[model samples]
Target: MPKPFKIPQSVLVVIYTPAWDVLLIRRTEADPSAPAFWQSVTGSKDTLDEPWEQTAAREVLEETGLDCTPGSALAPHLHDWGLENIYNIYPRWRHRYARGVTHNLERVFGVQVPDGSVVTLNPREHTDYQWLPYDAAADACFSPSNAEAILQLPHYAKQRLGTAA
Candidate 1:
């Protein structure tokens, strides 16, 4: 009963408002003494088979306290951009994964919130949060994958709302 290794699958959710204001959070640290890094809402799945969309919703709520209820007045406009990336896990953080697990498969999803939506941060998981313009948010991301994902937001926003983002 000693198995608690993490599943090497994750969701990278880009939470944005209709106006293209992307939410980015700075990680507290991989370790207490490590430097924090900026990323969108990301979390590994509870198990390998968990549906990617559910993981995305859970991570967003857990990290930011923002509810992404489906079909509500303030419902999250969730979209799957048909994007996924598989990358080697960073060595420093490998301890969280099972032995010899070297790569992570990340599915990208977007959530659209209304203007003036509330943001509540989980202080232990993230140090700070910002609602930045798409380009600026892309630039602030620490991981190349994260940056690339944010760069796609403008296009996704236009497609979703049929208007300027």
Candidate 2:
């Protein structure tokens, strides 16, 4: 018999507004079989051939339909939180991960955008979206590990941008 397919480990991009508001989406909960969850732009790293940054940019575009080039600087307001989290794949998603490989390490990144940049969602990956105050966004997340990343956003902004709070 063939072995089950393992979900690829991935990166989670926390796209935000200049003021630090986070972009979140309410995943379709109509399916009673799946957990109700809200989250930001996230996807798996491609074959190791690509650089990690490329993986990040690729995910941002694939999930949000926003093409962010490697050359575009994240308006001096953005930051990168050197935070990493490991969480178990949801029971319903376990088939994506290798047998016995239950958890994934997700690296967090912050991308600052203009307050009202129109977002184009790839309907297949998400149902609805919203721009929420960081705290509110964090609270709405189904994953505590993800929430922790959001909460640490400001600190990273300050440290990386060298700005006074």
Candidate 3:
């Protein structure tokens, strides 16, 4: 039996520190011809009806081995940025979705982890991770949407800490 087609709806969680250092993970692509690039935690929902927050938490844990669930220590730091991005799925990856599914709707989120928090990348999905200032991280992202999201981190961080002017 073939696997079910993936849902085009997903979450992009920007894990960061209070000081504005953003975490960027290098994805491990199946095709060597496809260059690997840095991005925040991202994944599609397991079921069509899964809540966006739930998907965010799951992706965080799966990609970085961090617990962002409701009762976990990181839970209080998890935040929904109330932003969304719609973009065309790369032609090389559109095969994971159903036929004719060329676009994806991504919900944005942010999670603040301690400055020194250790990140363990999932070998299958990511090969490495790094912490960089928001501006630099944004420049490192290959996806325009992802880069834009990183560029918005300072504003989101300020808002989260009640420091937004």
Candidate 3 off by > 4 Å: 30-36
lDDT of 2 by residue, 1-165 (tens): 875464456777788876888988765533657665788777776564655566777777777766565656543333346567788787887776667877887777777777887788878777888888999999988778778888877777676668864
lDDT of 3 by residue, 23-129 (tens): 99998883567665889999999999999999999999999999999899999999999999999999989889999999999999999999899898999999888
- Give each model's whole-structure lDDT: 0.85, 0.73, 0.92
Q: State the lDDT of candidate 1 residue by residue for 50-165, as single tens digits.
A: 88878887788889888775554434477777899999999988998888999999999998887777888898889888899989999888889999999999888788778765
Winning model by TM-score: 3
Write down the worst ten-residue block by lDDT for model 1: 67-76
TM-score of 2: 0.84
Worst-scoring 10-residue span by lDDT in model 2? 71-80
Candidate 1's TM-score: 0.89
Top lDDT model: 3
